[model samples]
Target: MNTNRPIRRALVSVYDKDGIEVLAEAFKRQGTEVVSTGSTARRLGELGVKVTEVEKVTGFPESLGGRVKTLDPHIHAGILADMTNPDQAKELKRLGIKPFDMVVVNLYPFADTVRSGAGESDVIEKIDIGGPSMIRAAAKNSASVAVITDPEDYQLAAQRVDSGEGFTLDERRCLAAKAFARTASYDATITEWTSKHWAKPGTINVPPVNADESNDATNAAKTTAPADNPQFPPTFTRTWERAHTLRYGENPHQQACLYADGLDRDGFAHAEQLNGKPMSYNNYVDADAAWRAVWDFAPQIAVAVCKHNNPCGLAIGETVAEAHLKAHACDPMSAYGGVIAANSTVTLEMAQNVRPIFTEVIVAPDYEPEALELLKTKKKNLRILRVANRPHTRTQFRQIDGGVLVQSIDRIDAEGDDSANWQLVSGDPADRATLKDLAFAWRAIRCVKSNAILLAHDQATVGIGMGQVNRVDSCHLAVERANTLADGENRAKGSVAASDAFFPFADGAEALIDAGVKAIVQPGGSIRDQEVIDAAQTHGTTMYLTHTRHFFH
Candidate 1:
């Protein structure tokens, strides 16, 4: 180890000049020299630090338009040499290289430049040639070097380097670990960008042969090709970021988060914190469920009330206020401490009505000033969010055992076409209100488990039979709840039903139909779809087939 090396010497170069000058000045005050390269040298010199440029140490001018500034062996050997090895010390001495005990570096503008709509060539050029090399070198010799990346590290790094001594062994190890992660994220960004431009983002809606999911074999490049491109088949994929954290998860002991798609990171409507405290995990999850349910209505005012990821109340009215009232009336008990979401703005009258309810969140496009004040007075802890446009992206993810499962978001209910594979199995076609109730029931059922059944009336979920051991038991449970919530008005006696998957036999449907489930909706892919149809016909019940099955487990 070069025993004659100075007690403190730092080489500082960074793209973000956030706290560079102060760090440089501190290094100088500690009786240690501050060496820099290119713009860093000029910036530190301007700050009146006796800055030594890289060219002065390496004895070579930067060529290749200044890209060759810090690629010299003099700088790298100092950072990479094994300080514990006497042979490495002798080699460094023969090469006349001084040890660099500290290297402060942040990468080139690649992440920022590519994030902007920069041209492909411009983005490729921004990848740093020497910064990552220096960082990796210093990190490799962390036992003898201190490396820092972020602006938050400025004070700690300066104190360690000028703390009447120098950095301890453990601190250098932590700094080196951070440097490695910084490089990894940088490389991932570059890889993502290469995939974006090479594969061509937003190219789709074509036949298999004509599909643009293919690329030219002759132009295949390592960076441009995906991680497992042609061998595994490249399916078009999209991504969205976590917009906000919720207060809590399904249970208080668990945690949760929510995300809004179809908006850039800084888009105004994407989880805008217009008012109130931060949301909880459960609050965010239910709010997302509510908003996603209502966005399907599009260009109209519809309200959804969600608790535990299932909509308890939902309604569409001529005005937002009417929708809120009708939906609130659907299941007043379930709506307590739930999440409310609508497709339109929160009006003063609607907010006035909603203010009395103990809701955890209210999400919409906007809120009137009086409405905001009214809601603010109701609950200081309530969370409010504004989102613009319909959320159209359909990416759902689940984490399990160090692997992530990605699937298409449930979109079967969006079509509103219950007729294609649907059966008018009973005596007559449904009325407008019955049809609406049937649609709502089907949408809610699909969100449940495989052997799921939903009984709904008055535009609200009467009861949901989820994850039952048998289809018959699930039907019985749903019918019982429907009857219990019927208000003795016989709503369940004339209500609609929905199932996520087809019943293997007709008994489940027959039992529910006989129990006064007037209509039914299920995916009609089973071989016995005809028998189920026949049973519904015998029971004088109406049936519809979604064809697309929603089997959540």
Candidate 2:
């Protein structure tokens, strides 16, 4: 088998014409025969490169509104023929079809068309049929043909052509692998879009069971209604393109890289980094946590300080600067070297306060010019990111031992913030200010890890304890931090506390009450609910039950 083959004949067809002129010039310089379809041929001709239209080789005009241009037998036979085989070479000669040494093709912009909100018919027309066929055929015959699917590879291909070396066996194989991945990702995108927009939910057709062997089990299985069709499709395919290779992973010993969903969406994954070194794995993790935490209070000036994928401080205020100050004051020691995120734009005032702190990353929707200038000058090593403020309602994925666990995002619903929905189970009714603080604490608590406790006053966290083995320990830790970290007076005094889950006993509530907490909010579903309520009433502490637990384990 020949390890190196010269590119004497080539087939090129692409929707994206970027860098096509350079490749055409290289083909002209190397005296390589080129055949392209329709607009591609026109483009190459306009670039002063001689080209043969695909129809001239196939002896068939493009039909079906150009959909049937490259689907002919001549085009594919040339791509798939094994020239090393004498029988195949003789057959190709008899058919008057020349074999292709190189195939350059890129598929239609189906994903982009779908994302543009085009009509069904318009999107369907954008789905290319002949392109993938040619790509796969050439890729399968990589020993003889080099397939190019991305325009980014045009420069490399042009250089190889200019060098007169064509492509080596290893180079062809690598290109083949990339070609297959491109097709797979394209098909997965089409499948996902069709399942969500076109497919209808219906009962699965089950095979008939023998009457003699039929039982209740078989009958039940035959009629079981499946989950929603779009959400849980018959086949699930996820594809992400590599975005960056980080310096290291969570630690220096672990290797890691970042992948993007290949969509024009808003989130930390697609955020633009304006300053600082490349983000590390842990930096992305903590920055994402903080970004999500602050967005929970959207349309308001909210700030979150996160460390190790857990929020140490979160607060909402009238301005971004005030919010940052209050959130930072929650636990300055914990906020040191933490990631910060703001729901609103970062202002000059906010940057001034952040300049003194040692923050690993700061992400927000936007940044004022003065603020950005200050941060870029004062903190050259800090990762400053700008992400668009958009609703993030996508599903979440977590890898397990052998598979992945998928669930919808645990978004704070409207009921979670409406004080009227909360049940006043113990003590006097909370006033307006106390109810506001309770709502803020409840929303902020979801950002903490399981067995979490958060104390808030004036819509800013004063204390937070998370990742404890028991609720009692978390309660004690929160109170301790509140009082010990107070700037002047006890921060826990007249503060509202939020628990992620129900307390098994009354000791947790007793600890908070003893720390001067005036109100407590939790999902009341414990077996000893009366005991817990009695403890709160005995201490004259206002308590509200949300009936919804936000366990974040």
Candidate 3:
């Protein structure tokens, strides 16, 4: 296994012919027999590179619309023959099959076809079948066969063959592993496409969302499908392509990497870095949290400052600059080095307002010229991201000890209209001015962590309490922070409160009322809802029941 094996017989078939001519020439110079199929063989012949056709190797012309060329046992036996086994060598010799010492192949562009919005028949025709089979057979016999799928590896293979030193077993095995991964990803893509577009009316082919699923090594790396349909289908296959590697995970000692669903836009997966150092693993997480929060309240000039995947402060203002200032002021200490994101473009004034803050990352739809210039000059190492727009993605996933917990993304409708979906439950109906503030608070609270309470005034978040054990504590924490920020001005006196879920007890409502919170909005589903409403009525605090709980745990 340690010895180098010379490449004698090579098969080269590819849909991407970018750098294959040089590779084929290198193989020819090494005296290797270059075999190919259909267009590839014709293209190589036109390039003055000699190549043996599949029909010549298999003794049968390609049929079934050129799909049955390489399915013969002769070609597969040649690719799969083991050089180290005497029996396999004797069998290949008896069958008159010339063993393939190398295989260079790239599959058809099924993914690209799907992306091109091609017809179903066109997309299906683009699925490469024999190509994957040849790659797999050669890869499995890596001890004797050198499998190469990526063109980037052509130079290294050529150098080895031309050096007269031959290909190393380790190189073969490495390429074999990559070949397997490539085929697996390809098949997974086809499976996903077919399941989505060509499945029977009653059948689905997705993995079931189960909390008690095993942490099997085979399922270590998972893919997230659309949460709109989370049922386990008849056929389930999952694969992901790595986006990038980060220096470390949440902690410095842990390892981490990023992956995407292959969509080119719509989320942070394809975010463009205008300026700054490379993003950390945690930076991606925090940036996603902030960006999603901003879009959750879209069309409003909103800003959300996030730390550790939870919104510390979020607000809506007349301008993005004012929004950033208000959101940052909610918890300046926590926002010191947090991630800041906005739903709209960041203007020059907004950049100036954020200049003093020691922010780690800033993300927005776009940046004005002055804003980009000022931020880039002020903080040479700050990570800035422009996502351009927010695309609707349905699925959300969280990895646990052994499995992934999959669910639908929280989408709040009727966020702007309080009277439409909310009921006046206690005290008095909110006035137009109070209702406007309550709407702002409701949208902001949706992004906070579980047991969340947000105190908002003047259409901006003043204080937020999140990740608490109980609702009462969160209420108290929000009011206390608001009072502290006021520093004697009594900011909470005319402020409104938004709760992520129903308060189980009346004490939570009482806590906000005692702090001079004039109005409150929350999902009402608790058995003690009447008691809570009575508490609000006793304190003369206006309360509305949204009947929609946004619990982000």
Off by over 4 Å in 3: 1-4, 18-22, 42-49, 59-69, 83-88, 116-122, 159-173, 199-236, 414-419
Better candidate by TM-score, 1 or 2: 2
Which digits, one per residue and each the tens of the lDDT, describe model 1 over residues 49-139? 7888999988999888777889988889888887767998889889988787788898887856754768877877888979999999988
Better of 2 and 3 by lDDT: 2
Q: Model 1 clash pairs?
A: 246-280, 246-281, 247-279, 247-280, 247-281, 248-280, 248-281, 248-282, 422-545
lDDT (tens digit, per residue) of candidate 3 on 1-553? 3568877778888889888867767777877788899998988888777789999988899999977779999899999999889999999999898998888899998877876778988888998989999999999999889998999998887887787766788878999999999999999888777766764555545456576867765345344333334344434476666888989999999999887664233457778999899999989989998988888677878999999998878888889999998888887888988999999999999999988889999999899999999999999988999995695666566889977775667877755235477888787788889888898888878788989999898878888888899999998888888878655566777889999999999998898888889999998999999999999888878999988888988
- CA lDDT scores, all candidates in order: 0.74, 0.89, 0.84
Q: TM-score of the candidate numbered 3? A: 0.87
lDDT of 3 at 34: 83
Candidate 2 lDDT trough over 10 residues, lowest sum: 221-230
Candidate 3, residue 21: CA error in Å?
5.7
Once fitted onto the true fold, the runs of candidate 2 whose alpha carbons sit more than 4 angstroms away are 84-91, 112-124, 155-170, 199-225, 414-418
lDDT of 2 by residue, 174-285 (tens): 9999999999998887876776677664565534556776688766644452444355444578677788998889889999999876544565688899999999999999
- Per-prediction backbone clash count: 9, 0, 1
Q: Which candidate number maximizes TM-score?
A: 2
